[model samples]
Structures are given as structure tokens and as C-alpha cells.
Target chain A: MKQTQTLNHPLDDLLRTDRIPHIWCPGCGIGTAFSACLIAMKESGINLAKTAMVSGIGCSGRGAGYVKLDSYHTTHGRAIPFATGLKLANPELNVVVFSGDGDLFAIGGNHFIHAARRNMDLTVVCVNNFNYGMTGGQAAATTPHLARTTTTPMGNPEMPFNLPLLAWASGATYVARWTILHARDLAESIEEALQRRGFSFIEVLSPCPVNYGRRNKMKPMDTLRIFKEKTLIKNNAQPTELGIDFERGIVLGKFVDEDKPSCGELYDKTCRPSLTQGTAA
Target chain B: MEPAVLTGEHYMTGDEACAEGALAAGCRFFGGYPITPATEIAETMAARLPKVGGTFIQMEDEIAAMAAVVGASCGGVKSMTATSGPGFSLMMENLGLGICLETPCVVVNVQRAGPSTGLPTMAAQGDMMQARWGSHGHYEIIALSPSSAQEAFYQTILAFNLAEKYRTPVLIMTDEVVGHMSERVVIPEAKAIKIVERTRPRGRKDRYNPFEPGEFGVPPMASAGEGYNVHMTGLTHDERGYPDMSVECQEQMVNRLVGKIRNNLDDIIRTESHRLEDAEVVVVSYGVSTRTAYAAVEEARELGIKAGMLKLVTVWPFPERQIRELAGRVKGFVTVEINLGQIHLEVSRCAAGLAPALLVGHCGGTLISPEAVIEAVRRIV
Candidate 1:
């Protein structure tokens, strides 16, 4: 494994390079997803001074600490609400929640649905590695059915959440899915989502070779190859049918995008009469 | 500049007064969930916050409300949330996170009767111990017990100031009666309200450390979206706010957290004493029980017993020095509370056998009667 030691690395200033040698293991796709986010954040032309990132506990949640923008590494399953508070408190700030599937979908599942249902103006990037990577590969909500994990040595019998479908059904205004192999496309999707007005979600299918892959006898390269062979790009495809299957192909693309009044905008609209009345009085 | 205070006398419940107090204290962000006995605080905030250009959010649950409060505070706004015991329990996890990150926020637990949802509308001081030790961890906390609607208003402002000064989570431990009962509350001009804002980071962004102690042992704060890439976590962190999982690191972090409050005990602890100079019996009490204790002390005094009342405003630090000194001089002590012997145990421990500390405690659902407190003081005397 080669480490980048260039003096003038373009991402040096944007990252907490002093905390370099992050905890992500080699071949871990979380780093790839995190890098893409940084690039997207930099390229989106958004005000870095008015942007903040929040994350929960997990390998992917570590993304917040690495980003140089004002960031918060909150408790497990809580990044979404934390970001929600940050956004609502100061509407001028652009808030993003970056965390893993387990943190966002398991303990924080209720918060995820409600934030989406409210159409909170937030950009949520969920890195779905199929299992709880930080906790020695425990089974997760997004773990594929029949996939083996530390907690599920007999193979996970529980079906997983169709993340894109969940976001779409939960009233997300924009939703998309991409794998780590599609970094450029993923960054572009994230840029678009960041520019969107309401609740936006993007699921990055990343490999956890040390956790989910080792149990299934799939090496890092093998998982990458599978992603290349099985991911079929289908723009505007139905979100309910976009489930992942290792042996069979998986559908991926921009599934949902629409204009909608965000929570802040709607709040002002709904309460304008009373608010104005109180102010006048 | 015109002060933000409403500057008027009005009839309001303790919860409503608390919201007014928060507004006077410059609390611009309120994230809360509706729970019985505490829901009025949220309602008042929702109605008033927007009018004041502050933000009010009704979160999905108590936990989210707490998490959002911390988040908003981290965003450099004075933030608060209110809940009952059941909801307060749900907020414990995030409260610990707030403590670890040294975030300044106010949490109002309008306590109701409970082992688990015991009585939603009824009052209890059962959560006295919980407020101090509720969140799992070995760190000191600041909790204020307000006995009336007026004190609820003033103490809530004090809670936010203490939180900012110490850089810790401040708990307002009021009960259902005080939370619901309406009384005349006078809101002073905002100029009269002394608000303590969190100290912002001083040095260059590149050289700044979020957890480095300043003059008062509290680190300066930098809110989110200010271009300082801050990394905060529940894990034991260093002065630079980066995780360092070592025994030495834990000791340093925990000691600063606990010591910052412990060393400032004189400044953080507040108690009101009535007629203690010549009294032989000092009845210790707080929250709703203080009203009963005051009346009981007066009655006991009229009955030729030298009784005085000790009203605890800051209850968590326990006011041990005052109790111990009173124990040396007073004939005995009577501790009154809604729960059975929560503060009584603390009083007794502080008394250290210098004088007998008898408990006049009532089980949940009703307030302790002044007669019952008078009886307890009579027995102790």
C-alpha cells in the first residue's frame, strides 16, 4: 500500500491532514466515498464558511472529523437530528449529515424518516457497507438477506431496507444511489443534491472487505469487480425495485428529484399569519 | 439598545415563566418535545420564539429534541429543551454527549411521578438523584430546583448563564406543581437580566483548540460553519478536541470536567436561609417542598421552637458546607421533599451525626403538607 506524501496535495487544506492515517482499513471503500464528498463540497461552489457536516458513530461517520469545515461527530444514530437542529437554528448555513447505514438506518431510523417527511433542507450521504464495520462486522439494517456477518454467522435471514425506496417513500425531494467505483458520477450526484432545496439523500454502495466481504469470501478486488459487473445504471428507475443482489445485477441511478417547499419555507408560510400578527401586536 | 425583556407582570405557569426567562437570557434556539407537566414550556417557546426572531422546533421525540438542542448550541446559539422524567431518561444519552463535548445548553426536567410513567399530571421530586447521576458517567452536573413560578423564571436564566460560564449542561429540576401552577411573574427589562454568552475562540483558526481552558477553566467555543474544522466526540478527547483513548487521557478529561465544577463550588452553589442566625432547628428543602417547609418553619417558630428554613436553589452541589455548619450549631434538621428521603439522605450525609436529620417525605402524587413538615421538625427538635 502506497501512501500519498506530496507536499502540496490539493485536499490538504480542506482535510484535517494532521489527523491523517485515518482509522479506515486498507481497501475500505469509506475513504473513497469520503473523498468524493470533499471533492463535491469543494466543486459545488457552496460557501465553505456557511457549510457544516455532522456524523454518527461508524467508519463512515468518521467523515465529519476529517472534513475541515465546521463538523460534529455526534452519538450513534443522531447525526440527522443534530444536523437538523443546526440547519433550523441558522437557516443561512448549509448542513450535511454523513454516516453509515447502521448509524443512520438502525438506531436513528425514526429520525431519518421524520426528517425526510418534514422535507428538512439537508444533504444526507449514507455509505452503505452492508454491515456494522466499526463493531467487528455486526449485522446491519442494510445487510443483504442471506449475507453472513459476525452476529449472523448462519447468514442474515432479515431482509434489508431498500434505501432509495425508503428515502422516496419518506418524502425526500431528491434521492440517488451510486457505488464507490463511480466516484465522478457520485460526486456529481452529491453536487446536485447539495444544490437541491429540500431533503436530499444519496446512498453510496461501498465495500467493507474486512467485515462484510471476508465473511462471504469476497476480497476487496472481488467486491469491486462485482460492483462493476452487477451495477446496471437505470436513470429514473422505480426505487422499490432497486435492491442489491451479489449474484444478480442491481439497479442504480437518480431515482427521485422534484421541487418542494422545505420545512423552513413551509413553516414560514403556514405560520406567517400568526407570526405577523404577533409582531404587529 | 432596547432590552429584549417583556418588562411586565403577568399570570403564568412555571413553564411559561421559564420560557420567558430563556428569552431574557438570549436563548434563540428551542428544540423540544411535548411531555405532560412540561409541554407548556414547549408551547410557550413555539409561540414566543418565532416572534422574537428565535427558532423553535418540535422534534420527533425527547432524544431528538435534546440532540438538536446540543446541535444548535454548537452552532453558537443559546439553546434549551424541556421534558419530564420519562422523556428526560430518553435524553440521557445525548446529554452525556453534550457534557463530553462541553457544550453549553439548558435542560428543564419538570419531574412527574415515576418509576415508569407513574403519574403524568402529578408532581414528584423522585428525579433528584437522576438529574445529578442520570447520564451514565463520572462527571459533575449543575441542577437548580425552582420552587415557584417566579423562581422558575429567574433560575432558568441563571441556568443558562451557569451553563455558558462553566461550559456544562445545566438542568432545571422543577416539579409538576411548580411547572403547572400559575402565579404573578414579573419579567424585568433585558438590561436587568444578566446574560452570559459563551466565549468564542480567540486565536487564529489554525492555532485554535476548542477544549483548551481559558481564565475560568472553560474552553472558548466555535460554532459550526465558522471555517474551523472542529472534531468533537463522546470518546475521551484532548485539549485539541481529538479522540485519545488512554487512561491518562480519560483522567485528564474527566478531572477537568469534574474539577471545573468542583473548584467553582462557591460560585455555583446558591442557598436561601431564613432566620438561621438564632434557630436551633434548620429545615432543609427545595422545589415545591420548600413552600411547605417555609410555612412549617414559621409555625414551628410560633410554637416556641427555634426553627429556620434552608431553601436550596442550587441543589446538585448539595450545599454540604452550609449543611455541615448548620449541623454544628442547630439542634436538629428536617429535610422535606416530595420523594421519600432523596434530599434527606444528602442532608443527613452533610449533617454527619452532629444533629439528627429527620425526613418529612411524601410519596408521589401530592405535595408534602406544612403540618407534616412541622411534625418532622418537632420530632427532630
Candidate 2:
């Protein structure tokens, strides 16, 4: 294989340069989310060789394919369980899951709740582009009411999920949300989440340039601009105060921050007897 | 002849025996959920494994359970999971992944009646065929069936050995009857029991490919972060473990996987034959049903009907040579099982043009009695 040096940074070198000039269109928010994750890995001091990136089926799921880490392109909505296995297998290795809104919320919704409830030591980075970008912009569980998509040409009738709140209630030790426009802060939050020793969820409000943009009459750039203007960030805002509206995105910040026993740590303490006895030699 | 001398004795159910077998085999990790008949396996592991300094985790579902076992195996621990029919179905996809990735692990399916939740508490061998082909695609499996608590323990140890040696998933196909029934089984010392570990690479780490075939067609396995960049997937992968969907790659990969077990047939396939030398007829069976077949064969002998018994200890890589040899001499064959004639088809195919083969089977629960098997044998004879 011919090796070429593109960007001098190690993160850029880790990327699949041959496949890039990425499939993501201009002004797509997925690129920002991907960049933030790369920066977070770089900042966390996690050895890239010791990291495994698991992703479900979607555009953001393609993140695993791009990273040079030992990655798994798992089945749709099954990244959490797969990552959970990897983390529990060797608690020393850093395991992260990258998924899209529809893949995580609609199809893998049960896994999301259960993973958080167990407080598994994993970092979940979900790119919420409002609709299923890969499937031509169908209405997603994260799509706000009144948003237009292929499934809801008139308007989305179902209520959008407050993902961070759900994670917080599900016993996630660390939870945060940010739009693609806030790349630096999102990267910082991801770093914090990765370092945190429990279930950590970071929801990135990415823009689906093709399906979500064309149907909503907002161009990719306009979506990012709207997210920048509409989002309200409060350091300590109550769940009731951070209400959801299409016109005004709720307070986006580190929503829940607490220390709790991670599943891996608890399991280690409880399960040590068997392992120690069998492999003590 | 006098009955075979046996040693070691403890009152325990088959599920508990299986757990002890795992512990004796040096299994340090167990990931499973609580399911009827199979729950004892997990509960025992949770209590005993922790006492032994091993790890036990109750995953949210069987999918995660199977995945965790595979993960633990890759991390250089002998790991296992136990479940019943519905949970077994949930594990099929990951089981296939384990096969493709060449991860060594054991899955204990305590058989229960099921088309869809048929009888959760009742015993059945309905999953006999599923044990072989439930996972999509062609791959070899080592499945062992036990008739009693003692065999459950010994077979579980054998299952782990086969899994490690073959670098494949070994299925312990026990049923609710055996899983729930309590019997005396003496636990063996670890030093007395045989153990097999995967061969590790010798030379430079950079030159090592995880899936590159060794002398036995099984590659050396190095765990994650062991400075070995191993790439594994459910897809048909090449020697380097990259997904190669081409015809040639698929041919090579599939052939190697199947060939590993096929070429080592003598070592992989095991069976027990009773009074076969001058017998005119043979009764073949496995699992709990084998006990019935043995009694019936003895009854036929008492009636001066030249009858013998062939008990299949290893189900898959299906004892073809032994079946062929036994078929050549026996006048006819009677195969019995708990399921409705699954393994009978294999017996028929193996005995094709040699003799008539009859199936004595029952669905839903327990084994068909010795009388039922005797009736089938009389008709065939």
C-alpha cells in the first residue's frame, strides 16, 4: 500500500485519506461531529491502538470505517451491545460507539436505555441530524414536531425525544448535548465523557444536508446557522426550564454530571473471585 | 460383563454439574441471563465463579451474553453462556459471528419445547437441527449431548477443550430433563483433567496476521491491545482478517474452516458402542433419549434379538465414519431422540443402501421410553 502524508496531525493520518474527499456534502454537520471525536481521542491520551470504534448502520456509522482503529461496522441499532461486550471483555481498553439519530433512537432505542441503566463504561457519540439521512430523510424519533421529511411531508406528528434528559434519567453518569457549530466545546465535552468512568452520552445536533435539508427548505449551512442562533446554553438549567421547541432549541450543555460506580468496576469487584481462582497461576 | 466402575459422587443437577465443569476447565468468565432449566447454570456460576475469583455477568439479553463470552474468550479467558430455546435463538447471529471471527467460546442450550414458547419448563430436543444450522452459512460445530449429570460435567469440560483446539464455538446441547434432574457426580481435580489452549505466534508481532492459518488451520490468537493489530468481523475475511467478498477468497476461507474439522474427523467425532460385534441390529441415540435406547437394546438382547447400542457423544462433524462402520454390520438401525426425527435423517443418509433406519421420536417433552424404542427396533428387525 502506498502511504502519503496529508495533514501533519496524527488524527488526519489515522483517517482513510483514499476514501476522503468524504461522501458528506458541503456544509454537512457530520464532518464537525467526526472532527470533534477525533480531537477528543487525541486530547484524552487514549492509545489509538487500544481503542475500538463500534458503529451501527448509517452515515455516522461510517465513522468506524474512516478511523484507523480496530473498528467494527456492526448491525443496525446494535452498536451499544457490541461495544458493551468489547468494554466488558477488557475493561482496560477504551471503547466508543458512533451512531446516527435514527440508528440510535428509533432502531436501537432499547439498547440505549439498557446500556445507560447498567451504567456500562462506554462513550456514545450520537449524531442527531433530525432525520434518517441514509434512507432519504424519513421522519426520525429525534425529528422535532412540524419538521418536514419524506415520511412526514406535511409535518412530523410524533414528539421528539429529549435524548440528554432520557440518558440522565436512565442513570448515565455523564450526559451532554451540543450542535455542530460548537465544535470546540463539543470536542471538550467528548473528552470529558471519554475520561468519565461510566455511561457517557454526547448528542451532536448534526445537519443532514441531503434529505433533512431539502425537505425542510433549509440549506445545510442554514441548518447550522439556525442551530447556532436558536440553542440556549445554561450551566445549571432544570429539566422543566429547558423546554423543547422547533424554533428555539433547549439549553445545550453538560446536562448531567455525577459520580456513580461504573458497571465494569462493580463487575470487577464482584466477579474477581472466579477469575482470580481460575487464573491465579 | 459387569457394570463399568465409576468414581466421585455428589448430589447435583445437570446445570450445576455443567457450571462445575466450566470451573474445572479454568473458565474465568461467564455471561448469561436467567432462563428456565438453564438459570441454574448462571446462578451457580455467579456464586461459585466469584468464590473462585472468576467473573460472572448477567447481560440484558442473550445477544449481549453471547457477545460478552466471545469478547472474554478473545481476552484470553475461557468463557461460556447458558440459555434455553428463545434465548438460544437470540444468540444465533452472534454465534455465526463467533464462528467467522474464530473466537473460542461455549454456549449451553438447555433444551426446551419451542416453535415459539412451546413449553418453557418442559424438555425437548427441538433445537437439535438448529444447533447445527441455526447460524447462517456453512461452518463446522462441535456439539455434545449428555444423558446424566456426570456426563454434563465431563462433556462441558470437553466442550471447552474442543472450542479452544478448534477455535470455534462448542454447543452443549443439554435438555430440561437432564438440566433439572439431580444426580451424584464426582468433580475431577484440575490437574487430572485435560486442557487445551490456543497456539500463540512465535516471531515478530508485525508479521503476524490473526487469521493466518497454522499447521492445524487454526491461527494463533492474541488479545486486543496485546500489540497485535487484529481485525475480526462476521464477514468472510482473508488471512489478514480483511473482508474479502470475492469468490476465491470465499472459497479459501470456507474450505479452510470446514476442512479444519473434516480433516481431523477422528479426533472431533466421538461415540460409544455396546455389544456391536455379533449384533444383528443397532439402536443409535443421543442426549437423554440415549438412556432409553440403551435399556431397549439390553431388553432386545434378553429376547435373543441380536441388538446393540451406539450412543453419539459428539453430535456434529456427525460420527459419519463410525455410523458407516456400524451400518455395514448391523442388519438394521433404530434411531431415537426427543425431537421429531431430526438426527434420524443423518442416520438414514449415512446408512443409505446398507440397511433400513427407523426413527423413534417424541416432541415437546422428555425422551420416548425404552418400550417405544424397543417397538421401533422390533419392526425394523
Candidate 3:
């Protein structure tokens, strides 16, 4: 594995290499997803000097600290609103929120819906490991029903959110989903979403080998095997029909891409007429 | 470009004046939720921010509002948020995050009665203690109490300056009476208004340590989009801004946080003294209570009692030395606040057996009258 690691990875400059040998356990898919994001950011043509990454508390949230961009590792479940403020303050900057399923969907669920509803220009990447990975794999808002976690030692009885549907319904202009196995496609989808003019959301189903997978009797490779066998790539699949079931299958693709004025644009067009002109202070 | 500061005198409520003051202080971003006694500040910002090229966003909740404010400030724009008791309680967690990250932003709490949303529209100074200790930490904070719309305007600017100068969240702790009552507020011209921008990284970004304090205990800040690659978190961090879990790291991090304000009390603390020179009895007060205490002081003088008042503006550093000195000479001290005994306890601690200290206050939802203050004064004397 060390031999395979090159002295000069193409995206080395984009990463905080000194902060490498990261904390992710071996076989965890978070690194794969993070690599895809870095590649996507490099390809997105956004000015690195004018880009920022914001994250909340969780395993995936650590992505902000590892990135060489001016990043904010904010409090639990607050990356969305923080990125919203960053984008609104300077429209010239491309603000991306990279966080986890639990952080984005559980405590921060309100901010998620509201940012999408306002059609704020933000690229939100949620890595769905299916549990609260950092806090010993507790049950989470996105934890599948009957899936076992620390908090749900028996099994999670709560229903999970269909993330693509939530994003689409909340007015996101772009929505997509993929797994760590679909690295190329995930990177391409993120690149496209980064250029999209309004709120964009991409959910990556990454494996938490030690946390979610081990308790379910599936190793990291076993989860990858399941992903390769049970995944269906269906573009423009109805969000209502999108759900994850390893025994059944998971549909993955870009489901929504449409044009609508973002919150800043609408504010300018609608509120401009009523704005009284005054000399700049 | 339109002026951010409105240059004229106008009659306005404290909440509206706070909005204008934020604008005047170069605050270009406002993120907040609507809460009673504080909603007017958001309303005023919503109507005025766009006109002056600033941004106003009604966030989903108080937590998000504060989080957004911190983000905007980190992005190199002066930002602020306003809320009341319940909302202020919700903001405590993020407010701590702001402090740990050294994000410069102002939070306005136009207080109302509360143990839990006790009275939404009624006035109270019940949040005085909460303003200092609400965030569940051993960190020091700077809080200012404003008495009227005029003070609200000036103190809002001062709050922004303090937050920027110290690179921390400064609280403007006003209350319902001052926030709602309309009065004359003089708006100074833009050139005359003093604004302090956060110290930005000056030289090579690669070599810069984001948490390295200079002569003062504050590091120059580098906002996002400045290509600094800065990492900030709520966790205890080193000068490099990386989390260090050792006991030494914890000591260094927390001490810097507390000592920055603690060592600079002379620079950060502000107070007003009235007729305390030869006084036998003293009244310790802040916010609207100071106004009533003034009235009571005059009434005490008519009765030929040597009474004086020490009005606190910056309440957090708690002008302890001044109070201690006065306690050594004065017969006793009477702390006048709208709450049960928040500021009174601070006064008592400072007095520390040097003199008798008594509290003149009520539970909540009502003002402590001047007559009550006078009675407390007579009793203490």
C-alpha cells in the first residue's frame, strides 16, 4: 500500500499533506470519497484562492481540516449555514460544505432544508456512513431501520430520510448520489454540481467498516462487494423511488438539474426596486 | 456606493438604533432569527441592509443565525445577530464555538423575562448572569449593557470594535424597555465613526501561524478566500491552529482565551461613576436600572444622605478593583438590577467583607423602582 502511494499525487498541493496519515481507520470509504471531492474541486475550475470548505462535527467533517483551502471545521451540524454566510458575503468565492450524514441530516436538518429552499448557492456534500461514526456509531437520522448501532444495540427502529428527494423537494437545482466504488462518476457529478447556479447536493454512500459494517457482520471488502453487485445506475430516477437496501438494490445517478435564480439573484431583482440609494459610508 | 452610516439625528427605538449602529460600524452581514423584543433589530436590518449593500438573512433558528454570523465574520465581513432570551439560550453553544475559534462577531440580546420564555414582551435584566456564564465553559466574555436608544447606538458600535480588537464574540446585553422605547439617536457621519477591522495576515501565508499572539494576546486573522488555508475548530488548538489533546495544550489554549480579556481589563472594562467621591453609601447598577438608580441617588441627596452610583457599561470584567476601593471607604453598597441578584453577587464578591452589600431587585418582568433603590440605600447606610 505504501509502494502504491506516490511521492507526487497530482492533488498533493490541494491537500494538507503534513496532516496526512489521517485518523480514518483502514478500509473506511471516507478517504475514497474525500479523494473524489479533491479531484472534483481541482477539475471544477474554481479559483483555489477564492474557494473555501466548511464542515461540521463527525468523521467526514474532518475533510475541511485536511483540505488546503481556507476551511472552517465548525460546531456540530452547522456547516450548511456557515457556508451560506460565506457564499453570501462574497459571491466571488465558491463555498462547499463537506460533512457527514448525521451532522447534515440530524441536528442540522433544519439548516439543510432552509438553505435548499432559499436556493442558496452552495455545494453540500454529505457522506452517508449510515451512523454517527465519530461518537462510537450511535444511531442517526439517516440510520436505516433495523440497522444496528451503539445507540440502537438491538437495531435502529427509526425511518431514514431519502436524501435526494429531500434535496429536490427543498428546491436544490442539482442532486446526485453515488458510492465510493463509483469514484469517477462521483467526481464528475460533483464537478457538474459545483458549476450549477443554485444549491446543489451530492450524497456519497461511504462505508464505515469499523463502525457500521462490522456490527452488521460485513467487512470493508464485503460492503464493496455488495455495492458492486447491488447498485443500479439510473439517471433522472424519481427521488421518491430512491432508497437504500443492500438485499434489494440502490439506485444512483444525477436526478435533478434545472435552472432557477439563486437567493442572492432573487434578492437583487425583487428587493432592488425598494432599496433607497444613499452615499456609501 | 451608498453610505453604510446614516448621517443625521432621528428618533428610533434601541433595536432600530442597534441595526443602524451595526451598519455604521461597517457590519455588512446580518444573520438572525426573529425573537420578541429583538425582532425589531432584524426588521430594521432587513429594510436597511440591502439599501446600503449589506446582507440580511433570516436564518432558520438562533443557532444557525449565530453560526452564519461567525462564518461571515471569518469571511472578512463584520457581522452581527440579534435575539431575545429563548433565542439567546439557543445561541450559547455556537457562541462558545465562536470564542474557541476566535471569530469576531457581535451578538445582541434584547433581554426579556425568562427561566424559560417567561415573558416575551416584558422587560427584564434576567439574562445578565446568563450572558457571562451561559456557554458551559470556563471562558471570559465581554458584555455591554445599554440604557437607552442613544446608548444602544453607540454601544453597538463599541461592541463591534471590541469583538474585532479582541477577536471574540461581544454581547450587547440590552433589555425590552430600552429596545422598544423610542428616543432621539444622533447618527454621526461615516468619516467620524471609528471602525476596527480584524488584524489580517500581513506577510507570507505559508509561514503564518493562525493562533500566534503578538504583543497582544490576539493573532491576526485571515479570512476565507485569502488563500491562508486556516483551520479553526471548537477543540483546544495550538498556535498552528491544530488540535492538541495534551494537558499542556489544554492549559495553553484555555489560559490564552481567558487571559486575553483578563489581563487587558483596563483596556476592555468601562464604567461610569456619579457622586461617589464623598459618599457614605453606593449603588452598583447597569442597564435601565442605572437610570432609576440615578433618580434614587438624587432623592437620597434631597434627604441629605451621601449616596452615589457606579454604572457599569462593560459588565463582564466587572470593574472589581474600583468596587473594592470604594467598598474600603463607603459604608455599604447597594446593587440595583432588574434580576434577583446577578450583578449584586458580583458587587458583593468585590466588596468582600470590606463593607455591607445588599441587593435591590425583583424576580423578573418588572423594573426595580427608584424608591426601592432609595429604600435599599437607606437600609444599607
Candidate number of the best TM-score = 3
Model 2 regions more than 4 Å off: A1-9, A12-28, A47-49, A133-139, A146-156, A239-245, A268-281, B1-8, B245-247
Docking class of 2: acceptable
TM-score list, all predictions: 0.97, 0.91, 0.97
Q: Which ten residues in a row have the lowest lDDT in candidate 2 chain A?
A: A272-281
Q: What are the runs in model 1 whose C-alpha is more than 4 Å off? A: A1-7, A272-281, B1-4
| Model 3 residue A67 distance off true place after TM-score fit, in angstroms | 0.4
Best by DockQ: 3
lDDT of 3 at B208: 84
Residue B112's C-alpha lDDT in candidate 1? 93
DockQ of 1: 0.57
- Can you give the lDDT of residue B137 in candidate 2? 93
